[model samples]
Target: MSWVLGNLDVIGGHAGAHLLQALPAIVLAFVLALPVAKLAGRLGVLRGGISTAAALMYAIPSLPLFIVLPIVLGTSIRSMVNVIVALTLYGLALMVPAAIDAFRSVDGDVLRAATAQGYGPVARFWAVELPLAGPVLLAGLRVVVVSTVSLVTVGGVLGVPSLGMLFVDGFQRGITAEILAGIVLTAAIALALDGLLVLAGRALMPWASAGKAPAEPSPAGAPDPAAAAAGGAA
Candidate 1:
């Protein structure tokens, strides 16, 4: 705790920069993933290609990506941008597939009903599909957030002076406390974000099944005519 207090400046800077780097990727991936997911749902071609491409991005080792970016884009670019681009690319792989899965999990009957009611794509998405997909989106976002946290440390390895840099410094300096502080703090941040996503999903999709109903019929049965008819026939 004392060690963490001692490095408050460094820790805060790392947190701020990492957030800056991560926010853009999250927002960008989500916005772009929407259409891609929808299209993938509608046209089968996109599903394979998107999953493949995102997986390819994930396969690109971060160290190599760090090396390649400077050569292609050249240095003088901000560290934040580099982190954003890499994270965004990484996020696309996870987000696209997750979005597709979420969209697919949506009830087709509801979609057809919406279509019958003359709901357009955007309206239908907002009104019906997106709500139902909230849980899956949260699931994906949880993965993305955790991945971003881990990779920000990787970015620090490239002289990015991120949260990872703090760990690296602590390790190199043989300051066990600082290193421990970094690890604990990072885990806390990840847990906090993940919890928030879970809470938000629960709030947004209250209808999503979290548990089974109480193992009995409603105290006041709503009168099922089908059951009543069967009883009468007997």
Candidate 2:
């Protein structure tokens, strides 16, 4: 506790560095996943191959990935780029399946209705499919957020600056407080990110908000006034 209290600036700098690595990974994975997922949803044959490859990519251990990515990327073993790229790959692995499910969950009937209303491919995708897919996509994104933040610590093993560095230093010096501080701050950052995502989802997709009171039953099904009005208009 005393060590953590005295090294506030050190902790803050590590946390900031941690976010820089994690956020870019999370965002890039999501952006890249959407197109891959859409393509997978459209083509049944490639979906299996993509899924298998993603699984294999994710199964690679983080520490080894940290050591190896530099060779592939032509960077130093301790480069932050290696950490970000590794995390991005992991994020994409998790997100692609989730995104595939999200798009598949949208109703075919709704899309047909959208087409009937003269919506072109791009407009329909942006206005209809994406909005309808928002809830499931958001769920996947939250998982990526937590996973990326936690995994940033793995880079510390390669001497990269992050909250994970606290773990390495604390273990070396036999200081439990520093390790505990790292664990607590990592969790707090994940929770904060998750809360913000939830709030943003609610703001952008108000229709998807949970826990709304059900509409009152129409007094023993008295012809459903709303349905009667629709019938008259038709």
The candidate that achieves the highest lDDT relative to the unseen native structure: 2
Which lDDT tens digits does candidate 2 get at residues 23-62?
9999999999999999998889888788778768789888
Q: What lDDT is obtained when candidate 2 is compared to the true structure?
A: 0.93
- Quantify all predictions' global Cα lDDT against the true fold: 0.79, 0.93
In candidate 1, what are the lDDT values of residues 124-185, reduced to their tens digit? 98998888787788788889888876677787767786677778888888888877776776
- Backbone clash pairs for candidate 2 read none
The C-alpha local distance difference test score for the whole of candidate 1 amounts to 0.79
* C-alpha RMSD between model 1 and the true structure: 4.3
